[model samples]
Target: MFIIIPQTPQNYALRIKQHAERTANLDIRSGVNYRGLAGFLNRPFAEDHRDATVDVTNPAEPPLVCVKSLVEGGRQTARSYHAVSDCATFEQDPPSLVNKAAHLVWLQGYPAPEWINAIGAQYRVDPEFFRRHLIFLQSKDNHDFAAMPSSAQRMLTLRLTTICHTQFALRQTAIEAARNEATNAVRQHQQRLRTGDSVVRKYSVFDNTIFTIDQELAIYVERKKQHNGWIAIVCSDLGKDLTQGPGGLSSPWLGEEPASPPACEPVIMHVPKLALKHPHQHRFVNVTSNGSPLMYQNASLLADTIDLQSGGDDIYLDVREALHDVFTLIAAAESQFLTMVQGLVDREIQLQSSGKQTEWTLSNLRYFKSSIDDHIVNLENTLDFLRHPDVPKWAPHTRSPRALSREGTPAGQAQHSRYRSPQGEAFAEYSRLSSLGDDYTRLLQRATKLSNRCVENTTILMNMAMLEESKKAIVQADGLTRLTLLAFFFLPLSLTTSFFGMNFRELGTGSMHMWVFFVVAVPFLLFSTLLCFWGAVLPNFRGRMQWAWKMFTSGAR
Candidate 1:
């Protein structure tokens, strides 16, 4: 149902320019002509698209695109898989769904500019709505995905899945590795200090280690903002086929008259897959299920749920259920994030409790502080999204009251009738979303508290590091003072010896007695010793001297 196809970069600016020129007269507003439009389109995502001279030598790898189809025949609903190797073909002459059908067509990938217009035309969407959709895609704003924008006539579903476990695991590994390296570096530095090596060399090692870890964390946070984003569209007229009453679509395949394909296309969805740029980048793997990528598996599961629950008969119920499923994925992502933050909190606690906080450099504290701050900002954004009024109200019922009244009526007095009102289902879904929101709120609170704890721990680590530095400085000053005093005490003795060793005439003729040299050296050595003792007690003398200086200055004044 899902596969990857190579998509090299094309002249996107030229495409937009041509399209804008063709549609120039449609909008007569000042500065709303082809040039402006082209400029606007060029600004988003790939700004290099604006430059005609830019080379496309390093084209990106292929990205995964999913195309799924569910069609109705006489007595059964048949499912099929499709792959669009040529996006142009998929856009201009897309595969059709049965007109008299209760089927679902899901296409997931990024659409070319022309493809966006084609989707608008196929869905009978308002040109204005599709233009906004086009701009939405062009903007590539992740926050909009979180906001879940929609229009009454079109069901625009945009979702940003959590960071894939592969990527998350890689980042976690990086975090742990950095922590271990810093820990080891700290130990080595302490050993060097004990062995009397130059402190400056060990300082460099610590600085480099911390800087590397900080850079890694910075990258992690930056990439965190850009998780796998997805957009899905459900046509407003999807329920029209169901309006034709029970037995599904009247298809040529059923009567066996050469079984021609249906005239209408299936509902297409788009998912722009990112190319892997590094060894540790996202890779397709089993996420919460086996044998398929996470989003694809999720899509399949969603299709299965629709097939089972509403039997693909009620579009409203289908959308409701789909949105609920999406929220479930979001909730799971949030829980995972919470767990990650908790791990960080625990690590900080471990570092502190194990007495390693004293060894932590300011750089180490900086990484944690940056990590905590980034997560808090991200969590606050997520929490705001969860608490947004629009979240619970998503996929609201758009049917007329009369239709609702008709659907609400019970199907006879049968005890086990499968007659569930759309209203009841909507209420149930709303309640589910609200409950999920509450859970997210609790998770956010926990994450916030954990982040705050990390902040506190960072502060403690900073203080401890400062204290350690102060202690080291004090010890160094004490050692220097001892060395200075020792040197000074022996200074006079050295001077006296040097003076007596000089080749003087009196000394050469043995006119000078050896006791004269001893007498002179002894008094000088004693005087130096007394001076060392006086300097040792110099602080006491300084306080008295300061008092005396104040009195003297006061008298002078």
Candidate 2:
């Protein structure tokens, strides 16, 4: 039954205290304290009323908490699809009416802490498992958490928790939208200033770019706050060897008998909001429209022919089959993220080469570096989860017939002992999960490569800026050289004129002729002019002079 708090003050206090006490009772030896569990329980659920005008399929829309299950339609009849708003539906349905063979429950979005607590209690699962599992999934870092005992190793149960790295264009789209909006605002401000408006006087290219990039950075951070949690499946053991019975019970989720036991009845799969099928992924929904709602789109129909042929002993085959679409969506999202980053990088490269790099380009490059770094963290985390030690084995194991025959004889036993049995998919999904790991590693490498490129581009931009500054300094020095040359040329002419016009006895008696002044000043002027020309052209003159002398000697010869 669901925990419903009454509207009375005393009742609210009682409920809060009860929830807190329940969370506190959870084993803290794992160092997980059910953090924020009480907070989610205390807060009222935000209801989203349906409206025809609302776009349910929009990636930006809030996700709903959907609980999907299977119920019987008739005696010896195929199970019918049933969906409800709460976990209580599982308990409310009669055991006879529900499918006891496999209890399949799918939750689309993150439920309240109370709901998770209730689910854990109902399934008799370790509350610490959910806590630790969530801690790994939601944290952005790739560090290790406090080690917890595996289900099989501790409680003789089956459990699997995996983090899938899914992507969406919400960040890219929102950041770009913010940039355009900022640019338009800046342009308008500039237009106002150009019209001599006093209100828009203090603005520069630097200001414009900083504003735009700051807006983008804010959007980037906002996007980072959104996270898609992990996928968890918990099954209970019947406390007996499955092989002992003639008609062995198998979970409807997996393949044949070799498959591991499925989680407890009414298997609970917490599919994060981030893993919901995109609008384009739905078969009957309008892809052109916004999107469909969070209506258990991730649930598997268990329609695999392999399962049917094997009597559904291997539930993981269906589990893997169900996740195929999720994986595909994740791939698409990753592609989008990479494409966005690459486009920015290409744009920067073009700008840097063409001498058109601006403050915006530089700041944007810094932001790109940060985004790539964040992406690398996510990739590493996903890789770490895939490589977890507690995961179920992938391949099946069967003894060789030769080894079996040898088991009866000493020599045969020796040979059988040496024979390696083929590994099987007992309880885990190895090959598919490993394949995912490889893909994530590849993505991580790509992200790292882009980060390096961003740094390189940033360095080159700084060097080019410095080069432009040096060119300006050289131009100023050239102007100073020209002024010095003019001063040198006028110096001798001024000196000669002054000497002749001085109040000396010879000059008073006209002993100093005007011709003398001209004679002395003209040669001095010519010499000064030559000196100035040498200062300006000596390097070029030396090379030209060598070439001319060579030409004249060749002609004489």
Candidate 3:
């Protein structure tokens, strides 16, 4: 039997009708004629054509059909629908298979949510199906979440929340597996180093490219933008010309042939944008990674990557990879922080423009502040993790030999002593080599702390810039308002002055009395002008002028 689905006021019935016509080739309205069931399905109903349709089928049961029809000329209509079979048949069809394989589910008026949920639930039958379906759901959910209405956003959020709950458990398992692998690799590396065998190994943890110790040079370049005036002066001094060319030849046999112009090669000095404050040097430690000695520098800014031999062996670990992971975390935190800041800025702009005297409680600002605090804490924790002793014991040590010489009387005695106790010197050397691991561990901790601080400081600087920009915008708005007010107050005075100063010769013939009258009027005019200027204009103008001056000077400095 045919059933009519009423249109909800919020629903886009017209849009649905248009979609059906375009996609399903089902004309909801055919000219002006009103068609019943056949025309509604095949063509369109002229009376109430705006509605949705869906075709449903079950492999285990007979096929069914349902359609939604709008109430005639009414925005609020009873949600009526037509069904070929009983409601039980439509409900019991296990919408999953139809949703998963159907080419045109929309044509039958099956809501997308019902189908998606059905398909997702059905994935439990097969393990691979579950994984693929979850991935699909995640992709679809993310896309839809971005475009969904606020109400729909909640649904999208629920979907993602479920996915996250499921995925996180799996992620934990994966992480545990990875940790085991890393631990095993580290142990193998330590064995090789203990045997004092030379080995070259590639590290997964550290970067290959070593940054040069030119951080001072980098800082100089970076700071130049902030010190524009100082930079200008330095540039001018360096750019001075030091050249004298021969003057044009004089007459009188061309001054016995003008002296030949001195030909000299122009001295070209490459002046760096800024000079390095100090020289930095580093040596490569022969802790091999991938068939090469791993090198690291002490300078935090200068060191782009470092290799640490793992498990006390020649297996070098890439510090860059670890740093990359840290950087990724930082970036995610930064994005969330930025989003919160943007939301605050938007609200602030709206509030200020609306001229509300009440202070705005910017929820986003608080959210952002909280987020940043958490991020900083996380960074500190991560830094602690990096400084853990286990992470750095991967690189092997390079051994060096030193010569011991004894003097004169000692030379005679040294021959006897050397033969008597070569064992003592060897013992001392062994002790020093054994302590090298402890020393390296301490050095790694120091380096890791410095790097973490650099990242933290950079983030702080970015946030400060945002804060300054917001303040600047507010100040600009206030200045504009003050300027506008000042202009308004002066407008009447300007009009008065203009009116009296006009010719207006037709008012009176030339007379001495007119001149006397004018003389008398001038003082009154001056008095009135002074009264208005001092009483109303001067204080406000002075205040605004002072504010502007201060803003400009402060900004310039």
TM-scores of the models, in the order given: 0.48, 0.44, 0.18
Measured on C-alpha atoms, candidate 3 has an lDDT of: 0.27
The most accurate candidate by lDDT is: 2
Of the candidates shown, which would achieve the greatest TM-score relative to the real structure? Answer: 1
Where does the lowest 10-residue lDDT sum fall in candidate 2? 215-224
Over the stretch 448-543, how does candidate 3's per-residue lDDT look in tens digits? 443443345345445656897999999999999688666655665565555565444455643234354456566656765666467688888899
Cα shift from native, residue 203, model 1 (Å): 30
Q: What does candidate 2's lDDT look like per residue over 404-502, in tens digits?
A: 454688865554444322342222233344456567678778888989999999898888779989999999999998888878887987887677776
- lDDT, candidate 2, equals 0.39
lDDT on C-alpha atoms for all candidate structures? 0.38, 0.39, 0.27
In model 3, where do residues sit more than 4 Å from their true spots? 1-440, 452-490, 497-503, 506-557
For candidate 1, the C-alpha RMSD (Å) to the true structure equals 18.6
Q: Write the number of the candidate with greater TM-score, choosing between 1 and 2.
A: 1
- Where is model 1 more than 4 Å wrong at Cα? 1-81, 85-117, 120-321, 356-386, 390-429, 502-509, 522-557
Q: On residues 236-326, what C-alpha lDDT tens digit does candidate 1 reach at each position?
A: 1111111021222221111112122112111122212414333232232223232221111222223223332332333322333334444
